[model samples]
Target: MSDAAVTADLETYLSERVRSTPPSGIRRFFEIAATMDDVISLGIGEPDFVTPQPAVQAGIDALNDGQTSYTANAGRADLRTAISEELSSRYGVSYDAEDEILSTVGVSEAMQLTMLSVLDPGDEILIPEPCFVSYAPTARFAEANVVHVPTSVENNFQVTAETLESYITPNTKALFLGYPNNPTGAVLRRDTLEDIAALVQEHDLLVISDEIYDRLVYGEAHERGHVCVPSIDGLRERTILLGGFSKGYAMTGWRIGYACAPAPILRGLYKVHQYMIMSAPTVSQIAAHTAITECQDEVETMRQAYDERRRVLVDGLNEAGLPTFEPEGAFYCFPDIRSTGLTSEEFVQQLLEEEHVACVPGDAFGPSGAGYVRCSYATGLDDVKEAVRRIQRFAAKHQNG
Candidate 1:
C-alpha cells in the first residue's frame, strides 16, 4: 500500500476517543516560555523546593546498596504498609497494605487506572471544573462519557450537593473530586464534603478522590481545612483514594503515587495496573517510604513557604485590581481578569508579550474558566512578588479599555 493508504489505515484502527482528546493546554505555554529567558513563569504547578534530604538520601542509599530491580507488581510491602499506616493516622481510613493498596507511577496513573477499571463503556462520570486538566480527559480516554459539573468562582468553585444532584443520571457511575483544587485552590469545607458524602450514599456512586495536595491544605482556624472524603461516613468502601508524594514532598520528578480502595475495587484496579505498569521504581518507593516515616517536618516547612507566598501573591493581585480570591490550599491563585475585558487566553498571551510574564489561561481547565488565569505561587517569593507587580502594571493599561 502507498504511504497515504498506510496512514489512513492506522488512523482507522485507532480509537476515536484517543484521537479526540486534545493535548494538555498547560504545556503549550511552557513551550513558548522555554524560548525566552526573561519570562517570569508562574505557569506550572511545581514546587520550588528540593526533595527532602531524608528522601534524597534514602534513594541514594538504595542505589549504593544496589537496589535497582523491579519490585512486586503491587510495589514494596513496607512502602505500602507505610502508606496504609499514614492514611490510617492522618485520615482515619484503614486498608490492608497487601490487598487494598497499589502503588502506581503517580496519581496521574492512579486516576487513569481508577477510571479504566470502573468505567464501562457508556457509563458517565461527573467531573467538577475548572479542575486539574487530566480528570475530564482521562475519563473520556476510558470510553466513559464525562459530564462536567461547572462550579463558578462566585460559589468558591465548590461542587455542592445540589449541584452534584442536578448532574446525576441513571448512567452516572462515579464522581471525581480534587480538593484543595488546582487553578482555583478551592478546598471543600466539612459541611460541603458531608453533603457530597450524602450523595454517594443516595446514588451508590463510585468516587475517585485525588488528594495529592491534602498535606498542603491550609486555612484560617475558623475555616475547616482539607477533609479526606473517604474518612466521611458511608464513603470509604466505594471511594478510590488517589494521592502522591509529588506536591507535598517536592518529588514531582520521582513519579511515585498510590491508590487505596476496598479489596474488591482494588482487584479491578490491579488488573489494569499490572498489565500497564508492573511496578513503580524501586528507588522512588524506598525514598517515599523514608520520607513518609521521617520527613513530616520537612513537609510542613515547605507548606509554610507556600502559605506565605500564597498570602503575598493573593493580596497583591487583589490590590492590583485583578480580584483574586484567596486560595485556601494548593499553590495556585486563579485571578479574575474579566474586569479587564479580556478573555483568559488574550490576557495570558498579551501579558507574556508585554510583560514577559507567563501564567496559564484558566480556560485551559474548562470553558467555565474563560474569564480567569491561573497564576501559580510555586516559584520563589521574589519572583512571585515581581510577577504580581508586573501583572498590576499590565492590568492598569488594559483596565477595561
Candidate 2:
C-alpha cells in the first residue's frame, strides 16, 4: 500500500476520542514563539525558579547512595508520610499515609488516574470553564462526558454551588476543580468552598480538586491561606485532592505529585496507577520528600517573588488598557483585550507577530475566556516588565479604532 493508504489505515484505527480532541490550544502559540528572536513568553505555567537546593541535594544524594529502583506503587512510604503530615499541619486535614495517598509521575498522571478510577463511560463530569486546559480532555480520555460549566470575571472566575447545581444531571458523577486556576489565576474563597461542599453532599458527587498552585496564593487569598478541599466539612470522603511540587517548589522537571482521598477511593486510583505508572521516579520522589520536609523557606521565597511579579503584571496590563482583574493566586493575569477591538486569539497572534510577546488566548482555556488573554508571571521580572511594555505599545496601536 502507498504511504497515504497506510496513514489512512492508522488513522482509522485511532480511537474516536483521540482523533477528535485537538492538541492543547496553548501549544500553538508556544510553537510560533519558538521561531522568533527575543520573544518574551508569558504563556507557559512553569516556574522560572530552579528546584530548591535541599531537594536538588536530596536527589543527588539518593543517586550517590545507589538508591535507584521503582518505589512501592504508592511511592516511598516516608514521602507519603511527609505529605500527610504537611497537609495536616498546613490545612488541618489528615490522611493515612499508607493508604490514602498515591504518588504518580506528576499531577498530570494523578489527574488521569482520578478520572479513570472515578468515571465510567457515559458518566458526566462538571468542570468550570477557563480552567486548566487538561481537565476536560483528561475526563474525555477516560471515556467520560465533559460538561463545561462556565464562570466569568463577573463572578471572579469562581464556580458557585448554585451554578454547579444547575448543571447536574442524573449521570453526573464528579465535579473537576482547578483552582488557583490556570489561565485565570482565580482562587475559590472559603465561603464559596463551603457552599460547594454542601452542594456536593446534597448531590452525592465526588470532586477532583486540583490544588497544584495551592502554595502560590497571594495577598488576601494568602491571608486566608489555601483551603484543602477535603478539609471542608462533608468533603473528606468525597474529594480527591491533586497537588504537586511543580508550581509550589519549582520541581516541574522532577515530575512528582500525588493524589489523596479516602482509602477506598484512593485504592481505585492506586489500582490504575500501579498498572499504568507502577511508581513515580524514585529519585524525584526523594527530592520531593526533601522539598516537603526541608524546603518551606525556599517555597516562601519563590512565592514572594511570584507575588511581586504578579503585582507588576496586573498593574501594567490595566495601565496598558487591558482591564485585568487582580489575580490573588497563581502567577497569571487574564487581561481583557476587547477594548482594543481584538478577539483573544487575534490579539495574541498579532501581539506575538508584532511585539514578540507570547501569551495564550483566553478562549484557548474555554469560551468564557474569549475576550481576554492569559499572561503568566512565572517568567522573569525583567521579561514580564518588557512584555508589559510591548503589550502596552500593541494596545495603544489597536485601541478602539
Question: Model 1, residue 118: displacement in angstroms?
Answer: 0.3
For candidate 2, lDDT tens digit of each residue in 249-277?
99999999999999999999999998898
Global lDDT scores for all candidate models: 0.91, 0.93
Local error of candidate 2 at residue 366 (angstroms): 0.8
User: Backbone clashes in each candidate structure, one number apiece?
Assistant: 0, 0
Return model 2's CA RMSD, one decimal. Answer: 0.9
Poorly placed runs, candidate 2 (over 4 Å): none
Model 1 Cα lDDT, one tens digit per residue, 146-228: 99999997888888999999999999999999988998989888788888999888998998999999988777711455688
Q: How many clashes in candidate 2?
A: 0
In terms of lDDT, the poorest run of 10 residues in model 1 is 217-226
- Candidate 1 global lDDT: 0.91
Q: Which candidate number would show the highest lDDT if scored against the true structure? A: 2
